[model samples]
Target: MRHQDERPEAPWAATNRPPMGWNSWDSYGTTVTEAEVLANARFLAGHDEGVLAAAGWDTVVVDIQWYEPTARPGGYNDDAPVLFDDHGFLQPVPARFPSSAGGRGFAPLASAVHDLGLRFGLHLMRGIARRAVEADLPVPGTPYRTGEIADTSSTCPWNSDCYGLRHDHPGAQAWLDAMVDHVVGWGVDFLKVDDMLAPYHRDAVEALSLAVRRAEQRHGRRVVVSLSPGTELSLAHLEHLREHADLWRVSDDLWDRWPDVEAQLGRMARWAPHSGPAGWADADMLPLGRIGVRAERGEPRHSLLTTDERRALLSLWCLARSPLFVGGDLPTSDAATVADLAHPGLLEVAHRSGGGRELLREGPTGAETAVWGAATPDGATRWVGVFSTAAEARRVRVPAAAAGLPGAPDVVVDVWSGERVPLASAGPATGGDTVLDVEVPAHGVRLLRLGTRAHSGTPGPEEHTWQG
Candidate 1:
């Protein structure tokens, strides 16, 4: 890992806040068509009547296998025949993306998305395409073949579409440079590179980061670079991670299961300190809304998680300040799910606060109350997320001082329900600290925002009481 002082300045990392967007993986798998992408982009950008656009959901990503013409739903076609150009660069299969028929690539689709007031992103399997190396295609603008620069020994375990690059080879970085330049030329505002971190490929990560920087410099276009599938990501890589990609996944694909949501409690606690601007430790995509329409996992339906579980999931992500990428198909989702995502108060925590971290997590294994806290940059307002990871409903309480606030807040507004939960005076045990006592449903969360001063903001009209 390189020292912090030695790292080059990355203007691309100036994305100063975690990005919020929609991704096609969960709903369309590897088979998402240009039409499907446009539908989701339209929903995100309000090409029709999407409310999420104004709520900060601005980027739309077409995830994985865009070049395989024969790609289908369920799972990737093993050793599939994917298409790339004579220069060893993958091209969107015209069969799936008709606009790319004349080697136009994603330019037209990206233009359509930009016209809707949203950014366009694409997912690339890290390294050179396997078939391109097999075909021994020449690395464009280089006097070398793709096979000569590919390290065939390193390949994805679950997918055989690509092989790792031989960083020692001079043409290795050249190939990445050309490919990145090609993709970014299509007006791609964000780029996701997968199969980079499962085994922690340091050299590949550095090369790819340099490639993105090189391309952005050449095209005078900014692109957010994300690394993924961090199955067992370690905190030791913090400095290196910050110097490279915009946001890197801290865990493998998080789905809409309670256990999946439960597991992130520890990951977020460990990684939140390093999350800010372009250097976030991603908790994976929010698997809410309607997932599994034609996914790599499960059958088509609304998310398997209950309403309470979904609330906990989003609250955890926002309070921890992780990036938000909805894994579900947005256009086909129900109104309630859509509204929950676009809620003003909930998003404010992610957009307006700082100092996000886990305050404490106590109680038994299945009955834990995890508290996470954050505040506005000026520290005038604070946010707390009280989560119930129990098998049944329970009342949890935490003192304002313990929650790291200046004192008892003038008003405590629940970010989710927009209701007021008045602070209660505690006895001698807590040293006279005011506390918030409330009944939290099993697998549910109470996301709270505090005004340390007099009425900085008021809660919604509806009032709810947990106890007197």
Candidate 2:
């Protein structure tokens, strides 16, 4: 039992750690079938010793366009035929999700996932579906029609599925409340509301948060809120985000490219300081394993990133304490990727450590490594993430005093390997100060836990073969 002060202070502190899960977008795009989702859920549930669930990777999110009956691979079908009920609430496509037939919606799917001991999530764009507005369906428990609440002029720039809502309209709040009511009843515990952060749609964001809170109070269930496609989410909105969301993306959709992964080092550095029990700055999903099967942006293949790069991708997310959603089919992903997902030492930093902050980003573009530091929840020890942002291999000499690390670390444990990092020499070439030089490959990362001993009773290492 946690003490009062040790407990998280967020209004909805039930979910203090980053929400970790498997997202369907990278593997199947908007075309995933119910069977595919269940298969992934079964893997993540980890009947096999509960490996992933034990690591705090437990949510299963059905990504965007689930309501489109004929949604396909490669990209969104412009003006897709979206399914909705008479109440203006979106429903899962019966063709793709057979259990959603007979007006059941996602009830059966959510039930199946719940039985496996995982939270169920759905991805929906902000505002009302244009199809629902065109149909003029009545809002449940309200006299208003969907058309009366929709702001037709405010449409998504990239997707034609939705039109922004007029927040001032009484019908708008009713619409969102009714929508949240429907999903919460279906056992939806996580909601990913997209198309709001790229330009920071303040009104839409608040409306949804209010809707979710109302629904939670009415139903006695918690729904985690996540906003996305953070093209340029400003720091000025940090307070607003904390009041509303459990997490928000700090960067755009991250894929399996070194540039995509490298770009996040800067974004996470800026956002990590604000992360804590209150909220998380999502670096976006880990596009490791067998991705691009029916992905929106790429052809069928395993992740394009190398072994070192893949480790770096997951490592950076851990260091930033970003939400840990995987964008690959777990059952079909490579063994290395699967094992990486179950790393307890790596996940401990993401789950139980204090907020992370960037210490240094050295050298020129594509030829540098950045250092970031964060502490254990107890605040007695420190963990550091050293990232290689280079286009080639190089040795990074980290001066203890200059980089804000311990000159003589009580412990030098590798987060990935779970073995001790040998500090044969502890200074720069000048020997002016204590330093630890680690050779990192292009776009790779080395996560180390230094200072006092690791947490007591923390599980053993997740067993990684990667080295600096």
Candidate 3:
């Protein structure tokens, strides 16, 4: 690894925060092709609904195995069982991406994405660019062949396809440096390398970071590095990843379940402080809109999230400071779902300065999961999600102090209704306990925006009205 001082400034050194965008892996899986990538890019670029770029989602990431596949009589490997080409590089399977036919990487595909005014991302794995080493491809500068297997000893426990790169090996560093240089040369803006965290390969993870840093220097451009699948990344590794990667997944593949969202958001509470302008902790992709997922049979289905579930998913994503990687077939999604995801106010909070802390408070009725996020420039917004979590509608009491304020909230707006339900009057509303009987439906949450009085704002009557 090059000395930190000798190296040029990191792309995020001036600003540390997450890169917001859409990734294909969460919903589409390996079925994603070059055509689908271009279509999504076109849709994102053409739509003024602000679905793609509104919520800090700028990059359209194409995740996982981008190689040619030989048809097998039987089935293929679950862990992306496919072969690479003679050049020791993963080429787009000609059948899937005709544009990349002549032994080229996804350069043509990436160029189209760039033409659409959006960035392109690629997925990779640790180790000797697997197929390249098998072919004994020579490294560009040195006589050392890139085919040498540094360490087949460490393979990702879950993924059987590739082994971890040996950081201690003689030419391991050169191998990684070469692979990154190759991708960077392809005009790939973001690289989401898998298996570094899951297999708990710390040495290789560190090496990959250094390699990316070196690649940036060699290319003289900013190619953001991202780590994936948050299942095994320890806080220690995460902190280290933050130093090198522009974004890191804080959890494994998150879907549209309420319980799963709760667990994921809970994990992010501990990782919130790590979020800034450049470094962000990703909570996986957004499974909103028309999610094209397969059932037991080969038939596909619409989105997995219901309308309410989609709202909750968006809420949690904003609260968790996760990059909003929209994973769905954009062309087929319903207009309503698209519009909901494109809510400017909501997206602004999710992207820009929305990265902040989540405060969870429990009351006699239920628990209120409050995500306080900073907005763009100088404003801070709070999403207080109150859940009954009970069999029946639970009437919960809300104290003024429970909302993280001195007295009562000058402005209590329902995020769903977009109405200002005042919780306070002029002067000091109540220094003592000003209780509110909140009726939360069974398994339902009431999302409210808590803010101070808008310069000339007056507290509405509903703020103190007990909804019977």
Best by TM-score: 1
- C-alpha displacement of 154 in model 2, angstroms? 0.6
Pitting candidate 2 against candidate 3, the one with the higher TM-score is: 2
lDDT of 1 by residue, 316-337 (tens): 8988889999988888887778
Give the C-alpha miss distance for residue 246 in model 2, angstroms.
Answer: 1.2
Worst ten in a row by lDDT for model 3: 459-468
lDDT of 2 by residue, 271-341 (tens): 98887667788899889889888889888889999988988878777777788899898888888878777
Error of 2 at 405 (Å): 2.4
Pick the lDDT winner.
1
Residue 204 error, candidate 1, Å: 0.4
TM per candidate comes to: 0.93, 0.92, 0.83
Q: Write the per-residue lDDT of candidate 3 for residues 15-62, one digit (tens) a residue.
A: 222465667764456656777788788788777754455334568888
Better of 1 and 3 by TM-score: 1
Q: Model 1 — which ten-residue stretch has the worst lDDT? A: 459-468
Q: lDDT per model, in order?
A: 0.84, 0.81, 0.62
